[model samples]
Target: MIGKVPKPGKSFGGCIEYNVLKKDAAVLYADGVRIDKVAHTIDDFNMQRKMNPSLGQAVGHIALSWSPNDKGKLDDEKMVEIAKEYLQKMKIQDTQVLMVRHKDKEHPHLHIVYNRVNNQGKTITDKFQHYNNLKFSKQLTLKYGMYMAKGKEQVNRPQLKGIDKLKYELHDTIKAAIKKVNNITELKKELAKQGIDTYFKFRSGTSEIQGISFGKGKYKFKGSEIDRSLSYSKITQAIQQNVQQRESEQVQHKQFVSDLKAAVQSQTSAFPQRQSTGGKSLLEVLLTPEYIEPMPYIYDTDERKKKRKKAKSDL
Candidate 1:
């Protein structure tokens, strides 16, 4: 494994955001911070900096990544253990910290964001930190031999043959199909086009499913044998998650369109109103109420008043 620490920052908000908010990101461990929401997490880190208010750069960020060869060997628990040790050797202990794993790349990697201000309100010195990182990263790698193995997918593929070739082909095909499909039924349909068939093993004398297998040409293999992530349970969970995510994106899109329309209507006059209004479809004109002209009034003349006026008209 290797460790890279970036320059410290004055604010925790952006640093925390970059680590925790990304595709396939997971929070493996945290200390002295809330994990429920990004806003709360940032607030927790900032609240800690109140101890050493004089420290301009309070955010410490590190990215720990392992070779793709070690991806299978390094689970979250193992990664967290290494991270805590790395922090200790670097003398970055007793600080508010968060560790998050990201699967966006082929190699397994994680991020660590911590406060430079310790619990005792003293600033943690970062002097000679890069040198320390170089030494400790090598030391830790030697201590964990399994992580130093060759990468799993480093072999040449074009020359492969037999069941091994088929297995790798299926692994790649299934992975690609999973992204486009939302469920196993749909995946089966997609794979069928590629001359692959899916079969489910059921419990004896019962409709309950126990396992799954895939077939192509003459050979068949269990889902787990091809790849652990290709197993029935994990695939089903992934499909369900895809469904939920699609629904969420659709809702967000609808809300965005709604908000955009509302904003357009609210501030339509902000732009050139001359053509917007029927007269000047502008905002000011559209917002003003239409004007109405009042009707003229007339009075009726009485006969008795007219006769009195005629008698006095002798003058």
Candidate 2:
């Protein structure tokens, strides 16, 4: 097992985040902590109360992940023991440590949570401390001789049988088609030509995200499911970027319309009018209140009034 420990630093919004990354080579057992429970406790004591739930700071979070080769051979009890070892190595003595095994994915991992400041009032300083955790984890791996992930070969050759190769190639072909096409119509045609049929669906109260599944020569992809850059930062960043670009274009179009209207209003003139007799307003005679009751009258010149009077008589 290998580990990478990074120093605690300010997060995107200026709040400090203390995190630890551990490669879980030992597949004993796995568990998880309820983040709300942990966050509530941490927030109640470590921060001033606030109405915003996400406003609280993250005291500390530790993630232990490992690639799994055997799904059924995990030791649950040993997994908790290993978690305790990590806490001991981190020198967290008096804090409540929660350990959980997450089985959502193929691999098993342990997520641990502990207070940075111990009950004894001792603060754990960030002193290249992650190195210690990694060192201990490596030592444990060596002691147990757990299944370690092999490093990438220099020649970049994959080890797969003939049937496996065909399955993998088909998977890649479908994946490539999905990436190239924009809308569903084009994607379906492309997949059909490649002897693959796809289905799309959506779920509510979940991620509001989309996903794809391939099985038995059938391909299914949700237009919104696959993330373009999963290897990058949080998924929210990508979503936010797409939304901002759309909003920016909308704002530019609105501004263009506004400028065009302003230009026309500033440069254009109204229709020319004839003078009125008796020094009355030309609009008043043209639109007399008596003729269009309850509306303001438009008095016009004698010539213009004569034309309107003639038109009313014809009507």
Candidate 3:
């Protein structure tokens, strides 16, 4: 479940009627007001606001939306119970509130309209309400075992409206561009192609960058505003990690090539050294003639006969 606490508006009647009188909208719960009709309920809330005219923003609005995966698990009665619990946790007692369940969307959601002006004529504080709402919503979701939507990655960007859509678009674009970049300068250059201008928030009277923000057209958002992971410190850390990883890989590759060359040189040098020590030199091997044994002596037949005849005649 996620809660969106919009800025409080001045008019309670318009806000109340719109939320309660919508098509297929049912008032699951109403406190300090008549449920007979929408007009009476609006009048009741306005009368309470009149008690404390000093409070400028008399209207408090919160929309609690559940993940689609939590559809059948929550019904109208259970939703009202959860809304009441959420209100109690928010410390919004003694205030006129109306919880309306709308069937306009596929998911289960409730629109809560409450008077920031309490019954005792004291202004109900809205300070840190946005922060508190976020903290409490997550608590409720966890305590009830509701579907937890992963951050911006799972969001349907096209379906998002106004600032939300732009914020997510910036987040997705920046996150993707960050991966391909090696440093902050390169990151800025990459994001510029997508029309996102990166800005650095510097420390007072110093050159150090304290934070970062992105601007697209006229809209600008702090990096953390878009997504917490996109903050300056986180982004810088990721880039530095990439740099270290790349350098490490390069070092390993250089070492591998050096080792391979050394192996080849060792083999080549050893072969020639072995030949020089154990065998003839190249010059001696090339110039020296192979030994030939003397041919066996053979006497000519005529010469042999002549000698034999002479010996016989003398005898």
Candidate 4:
């Protein structure tokens, strides 16, 4: 499951209109709102917003999306249930919320329209709403055995827009670059060639890189934020592993060449009459060892020890 918390809006009129009046939109659930008509719902949200007239952004909107793989398992009722649990986990309580499911895309998704001015007229803070949305949505995804997407490959690139599109572009570019380069410096150079910039967050007063971010055009996102596997340490570890693997392969190749030369020398020199197994070359037989299962081990039992002890007593 994926969740997006759009920037808060000043009014619910446009937000409610889009979610409610869309062609494929269906209002699955409503709380603390008049469900009789669209205007009534808008008025209900406005009346609640009046409680906290000082707050500018009283419209809180969130979009929850699931992969196409989960289309079968999710129904309107089940989605509303999960959405409520998600809202509860996100601390969006004491607020008026309207959940509407839309069948516009291949995936099952819903839009949650909520009042920032909650039931008691208190402002619902959105300080960590983005982080919380990500954290809680994932928690619910696993908690309910929802279809877990393996990676970004399952994402529909064409359907992505705005900040999401930029983030995924960075993810794909960085991943492709990492495969060709073996270190951070080379990674930065490669990304630079592609018009991408890499920024490192240093540990306080130290040269150590604690975090990393990538930028393209006007947008930037933390490497870890792009995906956990793209973190600073993760990327560094990947470079080191690639370097070690290449070196190991080179050493193995050199050893194999040396062994083949030695075999050829033996065939021409002292051991010219090389032995063969089923007409195979000496080197071929040496390179491919036949598998032989070893005999099972047997341990001397305590009963055998006792019998030996009894025989010793006879002596």
Candidate 5:
């Protein structure tokens, strides 16, 4: 299941009509208003909004969509129960709301319209509502055992309209480009090939890049707006880690080459030189160790024998 919470608008009648009067649409449930007619419902919502005239754009809208695989699992009553539970979890109490189920697509989905101006004339807080919407959607999907989408990869990009399409386009382009580049500069250059312009948001009076935004045509979005993983800090960390890994490999390769060269030089220096001695090469002398006579063996053996005999005779 997925939830999209668009920014509230100022038209209650138009929103209600679009949800209720659209083709194949049915109002499953409505609270805090008369449901016999759309005008009466709009009038009742606006009557409360009149109490807080200072607030503009007093409409809150949420769309809940289930995967087509879970179509048969949900019925009108169960869906209404889930919607009411969702609204309660979202802290949208004391507000006029209408839930309409639409059969315009293959999936089971519903649209929620509520008055941001509650019955007590207090403005319902919308701060971090987008983030909250995502959180509550996942929670309810899991609690209800609905099909969970795998991520943006399974999204039907062609079916998305307006900013949603642009967001996915940027996400796909930037994510693919990040894998092939080495740094932010190369990243920007690569994205530019796809007509995406990268702009850095720098801190005041400093050179630090505090954020990043991507623009294609007239639409521009902060990196975090597209997806959390595409944020400037996350991208920078991934790039730096990649760079360090490459540098480490290069250093290891250079060290291996230096060690091999040193080993070759040492082997060449340790090799024995062949020198000619008295017209005989050192190799020949070494090979003929037995043939070379010592100084004592060079003397006459006869003279030594005669001297040994004389000594024996005297004895």
Candidate 6:
């Protein structure tokens, strides 16, 4: 089971869409999460309007898709119970739940629509922490004994696989490289000898970044694709253990340039300064404020000092 929390784009009208996949059919929602007893199609839109005169044109939506493992044997009652449990666990009491049976696929699933802002006028923030969600789903699956995928690994949830086993070595390799290398170029050189590629891309947060890549037989070791916080030494060891294609010189050059540019840009942006161009001065522009009068300064000369001394002696 995988859950994705993505905000709907303008195409979906700026509404937030929450979706999950289990197996079989996909559910879609527009407004309150429930579908009426009389499942109405687009052709029956006009009839639905007459039957329930106050039905709004726009309805909030929630959707769910199914996986092959579900095998068309899903418990509707259990699904409802789980949905309610999740909401309650999140401490959402006022939210309404709507379930719609979708005819879209072979497997059975329902669409659940919920109002983020409830009748009590309290707002429910849609903050989906991915790590926490994964943890919760794992616990829920174990508790319910829902149809769990048998062989698949490295999903949103934690299931060990062949790749995960090798990840341990890769972790060490990446760390080793980071420790010894001065710049990206040197890092790429070290990784190339061991058969890994380096890539630099922007990650979600300003401080976060997608790290290097490595080649393993037919597969590539993308730091982002592999694991979170996977460092240079870790990737190197993984590549060494897997024994993939050695890093090419061309890849190294590209990595070198990328690292150099990022370093330069980072240093440049760190410091700020005002520049003076060859332009007119304040006198030339004559824009100085006239209301603020300039102060006058007096300089004492030798003659003035001598006269003051003579007057002082006479007195």
Candidate 4 per-residue lDDT, tens place, 1-315, comes to 999887899879999999999997899999999978999999999999999899999999999999888888899989999999999988899899999999998889999999999999999899877667778888999998888878888888887777777788889989988878978999999999999999999999999889999988876778888888899999999888888998999999889978897877676555545344577665555566682335786657987898899999999
User: Which 10 successive residues of model 1 have the least lDDT summed?
Assistant: 273-282
lDDT of 4: 0.88
Candidate 6 lowest-lDDT run of ten: 8-17
Model 5 lDDT per residue over 74-156, tens place = 99999999999888988998888999999999999999999999988999988877667777888999999998877687887
Local distance difference test, candidate 3:
0.84
* Candidate 4 ranges with C-alpha deviation above 4 Å: 248-315
Ranking by TM-score: 4, 3, 5, 1, 6, 2
lDDT (Cα, tens digit) per residue for candidate 2, span 244-299: 77779899978976776666556446634434336654433434544332456666
Native RMSD of candidate 3 (Å): 21.4
Question: Clashing residue pairs in candidate 5, if any?
Answer: none
Residues 18-85, model 6: lDDT tens digits: 33233333443323332332232322222323333333332234334345466454566666666566
Clashes of each: 5, 20, 0, 0, 0, 35
Candidate 3, residue 202: lDDT: 99
lDDT of 1 by residue, 1-315 (tens): 766666788879888888788877999999989999999999999988998888889999888878888877899999999999999999999989999999987888889999999988888899877657867886898888746534236534674555557778998888888878977889999999999999998999998878889999987878876766788898888788888999999999789767766777887667543333455534335345673334576544687788789899976
Between candidates 1 and 4, which one is better according to TM-score?
A: 4
lDDT against the true structure, each candidate: 0.82, 0.48, 0.84, 0.88, 0.86, 0.48
Lowest lDDT 10-residue stretch of candidate 4: 268-277
* Candidate 6 ranges with C-alpha deviation above 4 Å: 8-62, 90-92, 129-131, 150-237, 243-315
- lDDT for position 42 in model 6: 23
Q: Give candidate 3's error at residue 245 in angstroms.
A: 5.8
TM-score on alpha carbons, each prediction: 0.47, 0.35, 0.68, 0.75, 0.66, 0.39
TM-score of 4: 0.75
**Candidate 1 runs further than 4 Å off:** 147-315
